[model samples]
Target: MSTSNGMRPETPETPDHESWWSRIGTLGQALTALTGLIVTVVPILVATGLPGQDSGNSNFSPTVVPTTSQPYTSPPSTTPPPQAEGINLTVSDQLTDGAEEEVIVITLEGSRVATLHATREQPVVSQRVTATRAGNYSYVVDAVMRWYDETGTEQVTNATGRGSVSIDDGTRLDVYVHEETDGISLSLESATQ
Candidate 1:
């Protein structure tokens, strides 16, 4: 059909392309202008808040609290005490009735020797020795043949079997035995330094 201006009638299959462009022309330009304004004004606002923006407020109140009362207190010192020169030894045994035994040994180096014994759920033996010189030295611990008698008496049967003391310096010592034994013989078992 023809219109008043003599243009042919538009149908669904023949859409008016000019009508689409005309609708978006002003809207697109306005959007572009709005985006430019936002970009420019936002950056200026951010810049105004940045450091050294103006010296008028350079001497503003300190952001940190000024201590009119408690000045900053220093933390307590964390220095360790000076260590002495000597060797200390500790031996712990994990003794289970018929099960496995685990031992722990610890040694500390120094100049004087000391012996200590402990009996907890398990038995423990220890020694500490002080070195005469500043050089390397070694110490020994002989595992004497021992057993708990049928009558529950603890007895040392042989003094020949030996187990070396694991040293932690000239002074510290620790030795551990992990094994299950009935006390018939002194087994090397497992010794850990």
Candidate 2:
């Protein structure tokens, strides 16, 4: 439209620079959306597996085939650690005078494991007692010694001894009995392993 003087007045031209700037903003938004889509879709495709992918390959499967993080190892030892078998116990006596009906009772952990009987002929007794674990073990010994008096009459005497034996694998415990001044007594002679 012309002004009253019949001269065409200037009209502001639409800024081409603003159009360029808006185009750039639109391009940036498009790029951001595309990047977000790639980030979201790639993980899903890798996890659930892509369509038409090879099922024969274990790497492509959704069900995780455990790769041995460590090399093949023998199954954890089924057999337990070695345990002690038993203890060998021997009871020996030194008696000069002839005796009759000699009896020795051996108690382990308050349980009678052996009751050894010997006469003047044999004065030694031995047996194996089970002790599968390790620790201090207390035992008891009861002995009855019999001998003839000067009058040729039968006489009896009772003796007892208390001792502790440290038991391990292949342990041997020895106890001895001897005649004292008043009566008979018992003693722990030695312990060997």
Each prediction's TM-score versus the true structure = 0.26, 0.47
Decoy 1 TM-score against native: 0.26
Model 2 stretches with alpha carbons more than 4 Å out: 1-97, 178-182, 191-193
- What count of clashes does model 1 give? 25
Assess the local accuracy of residue 103 in candidate 2 as a C-alpha lDDT between 0 and 100. 78
Encode model 2's per-residue lDDT on 122-160: one tens digit a residue.
656566666646667778888787889889998988888
Candidate 2: pairs in clash: none
Tens digit per residue, CA lDDT, model 1, 1-193: 7999999987657456667556779888789889999998888777567565663556678455549688766669898987766543333333324322223222223222333333344454543344433443343323333446677777553211234333344333333333336433222222332
lDDT of each: 0.44, 0.70
Candidate 1 residue spans exceeding 4 A from truth: 1-112, 120-122, 125-128, 133-136, 143-146, 150-154, 160-172, 176-193
